[model samples]
Structures are given as structure tokens and as C-alpha cells.
Target: MVEVKLHDIGEGMTEADINCYLVKPGDFVKADDPLVEVQTDKMTAEIPAPRSGVIKELLLTPGQTVKVGTTLLIMEDSSGGSKTVELQKVAEAVNSEAPQADAAVVVLDRPAEVKVPVGVSARLGRILASPYTRKVARENAVNIMEVKGTGPAGRITEEDILAFVKLRDHGGASTSEAGSEQQVPNISKYASEQEVPNVSQRASESKAPNVSEVGSEVKTAAGHETVGKSQDILPFRGRRKQIAKKMVQSIYTIPHCTHFEEIDVSELIALREEIKASGNSISATAFFIKALSIGLKEFPVFNAKLDEENESIQLLREHHIGIAVDTPEGLIVPVIRNVEQKNLKQIHDEMKRLTKLALDDKLTVQDISGGTFTISNVGPLGGSIGATPIIQHPQTALVSFHKTKKRPVATDQDEIVIRSIMNLSMAFDHRVADGATAVAFTNRFAQLIENPKLMLLELM
Candidate 1:
């Protein structure tokens, strides 16, 4: 029997939620056949089978969080005839009794059924903490069984252990003995009861010495002191944690440099308004994506991602743009495939569908994969001017668009007039491109936006 353990899903992913299982027990699978889909904070990845075999068991369930190195599924080698048949029998037995079993079963090679150990309550003389809590206790050299539990199901929580440490330092007296439970005792009572020296009074009572005596006084070497400032301890647990880690890694690994340009998109804005005025439904993001697709043909380098494992750069001929959507949980980028071949109307329809799916959390693994570039817009929130955006890893660049506002700009003839101006900032990896190359690319992008006709042209 071979166990398929959870492998690293890139970007330092240590854990993920099991999204779904593609195959069930007793199903035959070939090498590289997708077995399950797992969702990390960053992306949804489909894990494929390592070898051809019959699935013996699925160790994890959907919606369960699994760490790296945890056994996800077990498969029996088909080479051994009787052994494979025996494995199938074991699998059938486990599946048939799994839902009805009162005790959790830990399946081993042996035929005899062995029950996994149940957790004992700390007050009952054994640690009643979870594996995670036990890890934390071991790191701090605290005995898990000695700590009192304040968690559901009598589990020992981190807060409970910290409170115990405070009690130990304060002479082992319960807070109730200090009068008001919420308040500490007076210095006199505290010092007398705890037998701790009162440094403030002792310093005040010291005799006044001569200047030489004071100068000759010895002092202990200073050790590092912690800055006693409160920090927002956001748990690095779900989607948000994944986004944060990926963004930080991308920023550090890729030498990102942003170049910003203001475009007089008054014509595009007028066109959109006319379309809307005629009772037509369209999104500004779709228009932006169409313009970017045209720009990418002229600047193919921007339509590429770094192939780090091969130590080479991969420039994709096909344009697959990822639209960044802000969901309640976190940011999710769903890709719109084959943008270069799609017309403006098709792009708009796909954008609408993808956005709805993203908001509803109904996006599939295929919808989130194969993005060559990304587009993030803050225009809906009414923020003018764009800022640098981090490149989604492997992708070389990301374009950030700001809200268009009426601003004065000098025309070619040097006459200033009010026009709809929008900020466009393209952040690219400097390691893959230089300033002149980025500037030339942005200039072409600016020209395409300035003249909608240029964007409509099929330039191969």
C-alpha cells in the first residue's frame, strides 16, 4: 500500500482545505490523473496521482484542513495479485463501516481493528489539548497536562496557559484574594503577601552619597528590551493569510518597479456613458481588459511569466488575463481564458460571469488557473490615481487603474482644458525588464487608450 502525502503547493503553503475528491475508493487511476482539489489561501490546486493504482482509502474529507506531510489518500499497487485483492477487501470493509463506526478507525495493514486513542481531560490527569496546542506548549516548555482548560470540550487553550504563567509569577495567589478580581492589590499588600522587594521605596530610602561614590556605582549590563506595544494579532488561517504571504513573497523575490502615466480617457468614458445611456449593460473592467489585450500584442513581454524551475522565461502567445475580485473573505483572481481571440462583447460577458462566480465562491479550479497577467481596479471605490500593485507570482506584471476624474491637461497645441483623466500604473519585474522597455510598453498602452480605434485593430 502506498500513501499519498500532502506536498507543498508553492509559496510556503503549509496547509490547505480539501475542496473535493475526484475519485472514490476502489476506483482505478492512472499516473498524473487528478485525484483531489485543495484550496490554499492563494490558489486552488488539483493534486494528481503519482502512479497507476487502485485507491484504497481517502484519509481526509472535504472542508477539512490538512497540513503538509499528512496522508491524503492510500493506494494499493496492482502488481501483487492477492495483496491487491486483500487491499480492496480492507477498503470495502472500512467504507461500509466508516459512517456507522462510533469510534474513529485508524486503518493499518493488520486485520484486527484498533481504535485510535481518545483525548483525556487535563483535570483528569492527561493533556486535553489539540495537537496544535501541544506543539505550542512544547515550544514554551510547558506541560500540557498541567495547564487548565478554558476551551470547548475541555481543551487547553493558549490563553489559559498564559494566565497560569501570570499566576505563578505573582506568588501563586488567585486573583480573588487581591480584593476586586479585576484589580491588582496595593504595593504594601502585594509586597508583603508575595514577598517581592519594593524597589521604589528602597531607592527612596537610600542615603545621599558623594559624587565620587555615585560615579563609582556599578550597573548591570543592559539586555535587549521588548517594545511594549500592542500589535494586531491576525490569525494566519484562511484565505487572507494566503494572500498576505503570496504578496510578500512576490515583492521580495521579484524586483518590482512601477511606471505611472495619466491618460486622457475622455473618449472612452464618453463612449461608455453613451452605451449606458442607450440602456446597454457593460463594465469598465471589461473595457480595460480589452485595451490591455491589444497592448500585449505590441508588448508581448508583458504577457509572460517567469519559469523559475527551468531557469528560463516563458512568453505565452495566448492571452489569459486574471481579474482581481474583492470577496468578503479575501481577494480572489479568476482567469478569463483566450482573451486575444474573444471580442469586446464576449470579454464583457465572461467578466460578468466570472465576477458573479467569484462573489458567490462558486469558481472552479479551471477558472482560477492559467493567468498570464492580472488587472486590479480601485475605480469602483472612487479612488483617483493609481498605485503600484504586486505581480501575482509567475506573472510578470499587473496593471492598476484608478477612478477617472475631470482634470485639466495641456493639448498638443499647449492649450489646457478639462478632460477625463485616469491614472494607469503598470508594475513589472525589473529583473526581467529595464526602464526603457517598460516605458516603451506603457507609451504603446497610452496610445491604445487614447485612440479606441487602435484597440479595435487586430494586430498579430
Candidate 2:
């Protein structure tokens, strides 16, 4: 028997998420066969077999993140006469009918089941982190090479990525010898270039202070202030980490200002009910998409991104509107492409299709990409009447639609009656366009929602 360890995926990769196993135990695979697809934050790569042999055992399961150089499997040597070991379902938990260790498994396709321990490997790959960790490091513009590993066998963990970032962000006193280090120029002294991302890496490597003599907030001589309670440290993980990164980017980069308008959609509600009665369950969101499409056509700035580097506003030709779907995994905005070209029925069907895919975690990268503008509905969540939603960074603007409620309204004849009203909250990048532009966009959309027929009048 020979041990098959995970080889280095890339120069910076320390680990990767086991996306799926192409070949299982009892299967004879040849050299260069794609054994597993592994994912890091930035890319997914395939790990191929080093030599031809029968797969004796699999050490990792799908979605199980493991470090590089870990024992991937035990394989029968090509020159040996051992029979191929039968395999068990990787997803199925090994029964404890026979007393054994935690990671022990029974080998099959033999005369008797042989119990073996598939322990974590101590072999270190060139890098020691999973691809996801490396990806986070790259997205934050932190170099993986600079991070110190703390996982088993001195492997890099997610916390290591965050630590490096924190150290760079909160530049405390340099622990290194000040005399030995080369002095770097202060960033504030120099004008920012078009490539802002490079500035950080330069600062990190140059031993230069970011601003005001390396951030007074980080005083190495004085330790951190004590908190009131004893705290438990938790990693920034999964959906929470993703949300934090986006929120931070949006808040820091976008000059956001919000505007709200109460739209009376009584007629729109009636139309929705009539559509439902006709055996078509279409949502008000579909109506809003069609309505917003008209507004976008008239005022293209709402469908534009402010290209600061070029000092210009990029008006997107396609009206791909993103519908924010709250999935169990996280909040994902699956875009409905070319909404302006599609009618209400088509939009509804696409919405249903994408929503199902999003919930099932089956959405491809294409399904969620290329959103010109975003619409986040608070109606389905059912708690808030209205909220100020943040823009989906670089998109320039987003519309927040609240739940519809019956409210008393005064008619043109001065007669009071109850009507279904919903709030349309618009948030836009103030740097790209002024308040007038955002307001005009919001008002036009509100008009269409109030009278759904107006959306069909100017089709496509």
C-alpha cells in the first residue's frame, strides 16, 4: 500500500475545499486522472492522480476543507498483487458496530472487513491553507506569503489571513528592529494613483506608515485596552464574513444617500390578484422589474456605474436587474437578464426559476453576474414597513421595496378611503449623480407601480 498525499495546487495555495471526488475506492484509475475538484476562494482546480492504481481508501469527503499535502488516500501499488478494496459511500457515516477510533473505517471487498484509521496527515504542502483562505487573503489584498500558519503541521488557517490583515490595518509598533528595516515614504505625502490596491502592498512591504506616522491608534508600547467582560473569540465565517466584506466595501467606497416615497399600489395589487386568479402566480416584484425597466430607459444614470478611474459614468446597455434572494446560505442577488426586453409573464417565470435555483444552491456564477441595478424587497421578510438598503457596490443604485399595507388615503374628490400602499426606498451613489437624478428615477418607478398598465404601454 502507498499513501497518496495532496500535492501543491498553486504557489499561494495552502489548502482547498474538496469540491467532489471523481473516482472512489475499488475504482482503478490511471495516472493523470482527475481525482478531485478543489476550490479556493479565487479559483477551482483539479487534483490528478500521480500514478495508476486501485483506490484503496478516501481520506476526505466532499466539501471537507483540508490543507495541502494531506493524506488524500491510500492506494494499492501498481506492482502489488493486493485486490481492490471495495468502497463505502463517502457521505454515509461509518457505523460504530465495531469498536474503533473516531476516524477509523472498515475496508470492503476483502474476505473480512479490515479496520483502518484515516488520520489527518502531517505532510506540509508548499502552502498550508485551503483555497477559501487564500481567496479571502487575495480579496482583502493581503498576500498569502506574509501570513503565518497555525493549523496542524504548521498550516495556515482563516484566522491567519484575518490576523495579517488586522496587523496591516492596525499598524501597531513594528516588532522588527527599526535600525535594520529600510525606511519607506509616508503614503499621505504622495498623491494616490489610479491603482489604489497596489498602495497597500507597497506600504506593507516598505515599512511605511499609512498616515499620520503609522496610525496612532496602534501603540505597540501600550497594550490593548481591557474590556468589561471575558470574551470568546469567533472566526469571521461563512455568510457573516461575506456580508461583512461587502458591507465594509459598500460603506467605505460609496457616497450613499437614501430617499423614500410612499407609493399607492392598489391598482397594482388588484392586477396581481387577477393574474393569480388566472392560474399565474406572479409577484409584485415582477411588476416592479417591468416598472423599473421603463424608469431606467428614461434615466440611464440609474443603470450606470461611476468609473472614477476614467472620470466617467458607464451606462450599461443591458437592463439586467438583480433580485435579492435570502437563502439559507446567505443573501444572494440572482439577476434577471434583459428585463426591459421581457414582458411581465416572462419576467415572472425567470424570477421563479432563478429563485428556486438560488434556494437550492445550484445557481452558477453566470446566474448571479451582470446586474446593472438591484431591487431588495423587504416584503417577504415581513417585519419592516420600510428600510434604507445599501447599494450593491459599483452598481450605483438600488431600490428597497417594503411590504404593502392598507392605509387611508384622500381621493382627488376629497373622499377618504383605504388603499394598498408600499414604500419605495431608493439608495444611490451621491458621487455619481445628485439627489435630483435619484428622486426622478424613484418617482418614475413609483408611477408605474401605481398603475401597472403603464408598464405594458412602453414595452421593451
**lDDT comparing candidate 1 with the true structure:** 0.65
Candidate 1: where is the Cα deviation over 4 Å?
Answer: 1-14, 17-38, 42-69, 72-233, 277-279, 307-311
Q: What's the TM-score of every candidate structure?
A: 0.57, 0.57
- What are the candidates' C-alpha RMSDs? 17.3, 18.4
Best by lDDT: 1
After best superposition, candidate 2 residue 174: deviation in angstroms?
60
lDDT of 2 at 287: 85
- lDDT for model 2: 0.63
C-alpha lDDT score of every prediction, in listed order: 0.65, 0.63
- Alpha-carbon error at 218 in model 2, in Å? 25
